[model samples]
Target: MSDDHASSSDTTAATPAPRSLDDALALMRDLRARCEWDRVQTHASLRPYLIEEAHEVDDAIAQGDDAVLRDELGDLFLQVLFHSVVAEERGAFGMQDVAGALIAKMHARHPHLYGDGVKRSWESMKAAKAKRSTLEDGLPAGLPSLHRAHRLQDRAAGVGFDWPDALGPLAKVREEVEEVASLIDPATGAVTNQDALEAELGDLLFAVVNLCRKTGVHGALALDRTNAKFVRRYATMERLAQADGKTLSTLTLDEQDHYWDAVKAEERAG
Candidate 1:
């Protein structure tokens, strides 16, 4: 072979294709070594980025953008490694420690994988795992209240503490809504009792979340999708108004409603 070709072959042979986890770790280590922003980041500094990256990954998944999803997922994993690195520096835990803990936990939870016998189904295995976890173990307090409640309900349900069907939760939701309306005292146009109003509102929200839990719907994600759709539709309305030489705020309520209806029709038609 020619000298240049032999040199290229030697280089290719020396560099092995990395396993997925190993490639991820190597990139993380390289960032910590050479990236200025990454080098200075501590767990506290990376907290917001961790949440942001996670949301970005979710967005990519929803949009079905494989390249963007892969990149966002890597960013999310980097945050995990960053936190582990900081913890390691503080003598708390390292990457190996994190991996070991997760592996041990998974093995312990999956008795089908490492215990009595093979699991017949994933549902039964999940139930077994939930029974093994404490009340606080399955649901983090820091999660959004709706999400936390759903998770808490699921865990509780695994232990036989749940509504029998959607009908029961639906009835409870209606009762809570009625109590909230009663708190308003519509004739006065004022909340004569603030405590009653607040209590009723809380109860109503809790009941709605319970209904969602029973119906296998995620209240938080449902709200998030609606919020995103509203923003997009409103932006389209604003652009249409601006193109027609008008400010959205200056338009009459009826005129704005007309534009909103048009936008809704367009979206539906599309």
Candidate 2:
């Protein structure tokens, strides 16, 4: 009599190693068919994962490690597969449609590359076909503030509404800073009108973001670098305090400053 237990061949049949894009899509399909979590996921339900995976890919890219970046990119591609499968289940579209649409758009965007034509600006071609009545027509509200500001400014610049150079944005940044300063109470050194202060602060930050764009600097990336630098220096300060038989919490401002200054001096010397 034949045994009912699963053998190595049976296990191999159940779990397959994907060898290509088609194999990956088939693997995703199999997961949806068998896994309860994957089976129940809808496009709307998977939206957050889509956003999170994109950010993880960004972080991996910033880390400058090819292996990690490749892994993150694969995770991001899984989101694409997930959405495509969900769409296919609903009879909306399939992965082939998704890939076909991308290829069509790329070909249309670069007629010179795919057809017999002169090189033309893809944005201008898109604008001709796109019925965008406002500058923020295509910009999503959920975009990061700094990136949104940069995109909005770029759109305005395309229509001849922007300043010619960095000097104009620099001047606007100074003006916005002064307005924010005026909102603060000089005596108490605190803002009394919270609403007005917030509005002024928004203006100041928007101006600064615009200045960053004008100067060819990425505001979010610049802030990310500063955040990392601060964390590194703060950790070094804590370590220095610990070595001196003190906890960071027990150290006074002067004591903390001694360690902070030492860290900075060492960094400069190194």
Candidate 3:
């Protein structure tokens, strides 16, 4: 072989193909060193990807396909690897430190398994570690509003500040809806004080979320399922309309209702 060919072969042989987590870490370190886009990234710059990948994993899980779930999980892992590599570059810590910290936290939380102390609730254990002005003070403001509300309710429930049953939140939901309705003109359905409507709607949603929590359902996941259902049904309606040489917008409200009912019946029958 020519000298260039021999040198290229040696370079290729030096960097083995990744087969495990250690290899993934080495690969990430190499990308940070050599790839232009990867090299320029910091934890701050990649923050959005971290959140986006997590949501993608959520989507994949909702879809309930193992293949898609595995791919999305890997995408989420990439975000973890990216942050770990970035921190390593800054001498803050590396993947080892991240894994070690997690293991330590697990051992502390599950002392029954690891030996020494009894099992403790994760949230209560977390609260014990912090000194906060209020329960909400420790929560990140950037959490999705629905998730934030859910977490806030969870924290309150941790301190015995919860309704005894779903009925309480169900009643609160009705009250919030009534408060919201009071802001609207009954005759024309014109909403007065749009800001008040928005606030009342928020209250209504919070009450609904609380009800969902009391019912042992995650509000976010439940909403996600409902959103997906709506999209599917609407798409089916649109398809049915197209089959009749019309679009949903071209149909009268009653005609649209017919299509919606048909879709619902079809779904039920299926």
Of candidate 2, the 10-residue stretch with the lowest lDDT total is: 1-10
Per-residue lDDT over 163-221 for candidate 1, one digit per residue giving the tens place of the 0 to 100 score: 88999889999999888888777888687789989988888887888898788789898
What TM-score should be assigned to candidate 2?
Answer: 0.81
Question: lDDT score, residue 170, model 2?
Answer: 98
Task: Report the lDDT tens digits of candidate 2 across residue range 1-270.
Answer: 011110001112133344799988997888789877788888887777777778878887888976667666777888899889889999999999999999999999889999778776665666677869876888887999888888887766665667789999899999998898898888989887899999999998888888888899988888889999999999999888888889998888998898999999989999
What RMSD value applies to candidate 2? Answer: 6.7
Q: Considering only N, C-alpha and C atoms within 3 Å, which residue pairs clash in candidate 2?
A: none
**lDDT of the candidates, in the order given:** 0.75, 0.81, 0.82
Off by over 4 Å in 3: 1-18, 115-119
lDDT of 3 by residue, 1-270 (tens): 122211111112133344899887887788778777778877787777777778777877787876667666766787789888888888999899999999998888787889666876667766667665788986777888888999999877866789999999999999999999999999999998999999999999999999999999989989888998999999999999999999899889999999999999999999
Name the lDDT value of residue 145 in candidate 2. 86
> How far is 45's C-alpha from truth in model 3 (Å)?
2.5
lDDT of 1 at 108: 65
Number of the top-ranking candidate, with TM-score as the measure: 3
User: What TM-score does prediction 1 earn?
Assistant: 0.72
Query: Superposing all C-alpha atoms, what RMSD in Å does each candidate have to the true structure?
Result: 8.7, 6.7, 6.9
